[model samples]
Target: MSTVLIVAEHLNGRLNAATARCVSAAAALSPAAIDIVVLAADAATIAAQAAQIAGVRKVLAVANPANAHAIAQVQAPQVAALAGGYSHVFGPSTTFGKDLMPAVAALLGVDQVSDLMAVEGSHSFKRPIYAGNAIITVEMPAGSQVVATVRTASWPEAAAGGSATVEAASVDATLPSHTRFIGLASASSDRPDLQSARRVVSGGRGVGSEDNFKIIYHLADRLGAAVGASRAAVDAGYVPSDLQVGQTGKIIAPELYIAVGISGAIQHLTGIKDAGTIVAINKDGDAPIFEIADIGLVGDLFQVLPELEQALG
Candidate 1:
């Protein structure tokens, strides 16, 4: 039986939705046993949340004074060590997972799989290639334990109900040599995090001007959605870099994605292809954005937008 271990993520005791998705994916690889490791200053809180994630066989709580802030420098090696007995290790393709999992893989001398969408066989998987324009299935070199990061939107989160046993896992207090803790900076946003938002309204070059970009926000606010932008919109000075969605920017898996005036370059599409529903509004009906859209409106965006707001009202 192959043992699979999943790393749990939390912010101040609130379990991240991605952790449950990772567990759901890991369970497909092996149902023999699934251990979810929660590294935190407060074990009881993390453990409580871990118990709620479905398909988990056990919750391994590792409490440490250094984990109060839970930076990767200390958490990676600790998690790598605790996961020693497992044949496979998994984490969500989140900031923490992207930051920490490769280091853990390096410590364990195994190749790390980044942004896996589907597992084919025990060792073969299908993942996006060329900025998600193509899909490639590859096999991991045998004789090594699998270390993978799953894109949360690719897997549906399982419903919660498990008699998962909770165990206290131990870890070294010292930080790994290759990393260090740094001061934190905060971003201001009343909206949900870009990755977690369910409804996203994005603008592009057709937005015309920086002032016109406000329409994106107005629509988003009216719909209770997050605001996003194409690289063209950001590079053209219509929006901030943080709002950009593309190969180099944020990947979003919203329930509804509105692409206003975006040309649907492969890079931008890669970031939002997972969205449940896509609506494209572009003057050029021939724009590639229409290819993936569930609803494509061919009209001048300037004329269409205000009417949309009024119609929605």
Candidate 2:
């Protein structure tokens, strides 16, 4: 049996939900021994946490102060080298993961599978192409290990079990640098992270203004949902770019997704196509959002949102 190396992602000491999702994807590829590699400024703490993830056979820790922050240059080679012994390497399709995996693949002298949706077999994989309008099946070439970044919504998160053993590994601190962090300008919010949330509430041009976005926020709060936006809404300055969900933005697969006042475009739907239950609310009954929506509401969003919030509350 071959081993699969999963790179654990973290911020501060908390494990990113994507890491658990990766483990779930790894399980689908093979039930073979799954090992999690943690690169942290403090290895002991991260290792302790990683050991609890279900299905993890071993936790490998590499503590280098330079690795405390998630930078591609800091972790790429370390992950590449650590992944050397495994038959496959898997990570999340996050910006950090996408940046780091290419370097790791380069070090392994193989092109990565990149954003795989399904693993058909040990060597064959399926992925989206042309902005998710088509699916492409690929077979890994000879002499190269399987490398892929799983889309977050494509897999369910595994539960964390009791403790497991951790081992220490040495990594070279010196690697190539492309970009340096200045400061993080994260949006201030209590909402869930869009890509990983179980429920999502999205707004669009019909939202009218930045001020009216509060209605969507209230609805999201009542439903315990992460907030998302259409590209037009983000471009119109009603929301941040990060909140945009589409082929060009973040892809999400929530259990429930509500699109408010959004006239869904093909690009926007691509990011949310995997959502389990889709609800669309738009005054224009013919809006494309209704085409994919499980439930469609034709009404003014201003009136509908307050009523929905009241009912939920």
Candidate 3:
């Protein structure tokens, strides 16, 4: 029977929902055991939270001061050290996992399978290519350890209720000195995080300018949703790159995704392909965004937004 180990992703002592989604992907393998390893300066809280994820058999807490920051180079060696006895190692295909999994694969001397969307067998999987326009099956050599990043957007978060045990783990890998946690500079926002939000409202270049983006934000706030932007909006300097959602930016699977003034480029559609309900609002009646949108409105956003906000009230 196969056994899987997942690297836990957490911040501020809280477990990331992506970790639970990884658990969902691992569950599809029907492995003998699914364990999570939490590497942190203090892993107790995170480990305890991970232990509650359904299908998890155990949580390994690796407490080390060097793990205070999520520097890929620093954590990859430790994860590689703990890979023994496991048939597969999984991580989420988020920015953190994208940065760390390749290094883990290098340390293990194996090719990393990325953005795994489906499990065909223990060693066979399916993933997207050509900006999610196509999916191809990949088979890992039998009997070889599999290191992969799970496509978080493709799997639902595993429910909590498990009473798995948490254990303290220690890895003796030689830590690299060349890389150190310098500092992190990120925008602070009261709004929900775009990647994990249940609902999102995104603006595009047609929103006019940065100042006009307030309409998008106001609508999003009224809906209690996160704010996102099309790559065109970011490129036009109407929003920051961090808020961009497309093939080149963040891939999200919100329950509700609203695209305002977006032309629905294939690249943008690729990111929201897994969204539950897509609503498009644009003046152009025949915009490509309407091709896949569940609901579309053909009107000027500047005039429609205030009325929509009032209707909500």
Candidate 4:
């Protein structure tokens, strides 16, 4: 039987939903145990939240002042030191995991599995390729510890009914001096986070100038949804690159995804293929976005948006 150790992803003293999604994937393995390791300056709050994830056996709280920030170089050695006695190490396939897991795999002398969507066996898994147009099964060598990133979009979050015990962990790894915490600059928004939001409203180049993006924001606010933008819109300077949703941007699986004035290029479609209900509003009736949209409205967004908002009320 395999023993799985999950790296908990948290920010602002709260656990990320992606960590619970990883728990869901770990549960599919039917492993001997599923434990979460929280590396933070003060892991008590995050560890408490992680313990509530159903199927988790225990939470390992490694409180270190060096872990105040999520610098992958500083944290990888600590995680590697704790990897002994575990058959598998898992992390979410997000920006943080992408940056950290590769280093862990390198330290473990194993190839890292990216975007694991399904578990075929203890050492075999399925993941997407070529912008999600293809899925390939990968098999790890027997007896080799598996290091993988779970695709949070493909798995539902584990429920919160567990009462797992939290244990303090002390890691003795040499910390590198090359990388040091400097600062983080991110746009502050009161809107829902696009990657985790259940409902999202996106705009494209057809939405016109940056000022016209207010229509997209208004509709998103009305629906209490997050705002996203197509790569074209980002490239056109209508919105920030952070809001881009496509192959080159964040992959999300919202229950409701509304694309306004988007033509639905394949790269853009790759991002939301797992979305439950896709609604597209485009002026061109033959727009490719309608091909996959559950609901499509063919009309000028300038005239259609106001009516939709009124109907929402």
Candidate 3 residue spans exceeding 4 A from truth: none
Q: Please report the candidate that would top lDDT against the real structure.
A: 3
Q: For residue 91, give model 4's deviation from the true position in Å.
A: 0.6
Q: What lDDT is reached at residue 54 by model 3?
A: 90
- Measured against the true structure, the TM-scores of the candidates, in listed sequence, are 0.92, 0.95, 0.99, 0.99
lDDT of 2 by residue, 130-166 (tens): 8888899989975468878888777888888846679
lDDT of 1 by residue, 53-84 (tens): 77788899888777777577788878878877
lDDT for model 4 comes to: 0.95
Candidate 3 structure, TM-score to reference: 0.99
- lDDT of model 3 at position 306: 94
TM-score: which is higher, 1 or 4? 4
Candidate 3: tens digits of C-alpha lDDT, residues 194-231: 99999999999899999999999999999999999999
* Residue range 1-313, candidate 4, lDDT tens digits: 9999999999899899999999999999999999999999999999999999999999999999999999999999999999998999999998999999999999999999999999999999999999999999999998899999998999998999999999999999999998999999999998988988999999999999999999999999999999999999999999999999989999999999999999999999999998999999999999999999999999999999999999998
Instruction: Please count the clashing residue pairs in each candidate, in the order shown.
Output: 0, 0, 0, 0
Off by over 4 Å in 4: none
Is candidate 1 or 4 superior in lDDT? Answer: 4
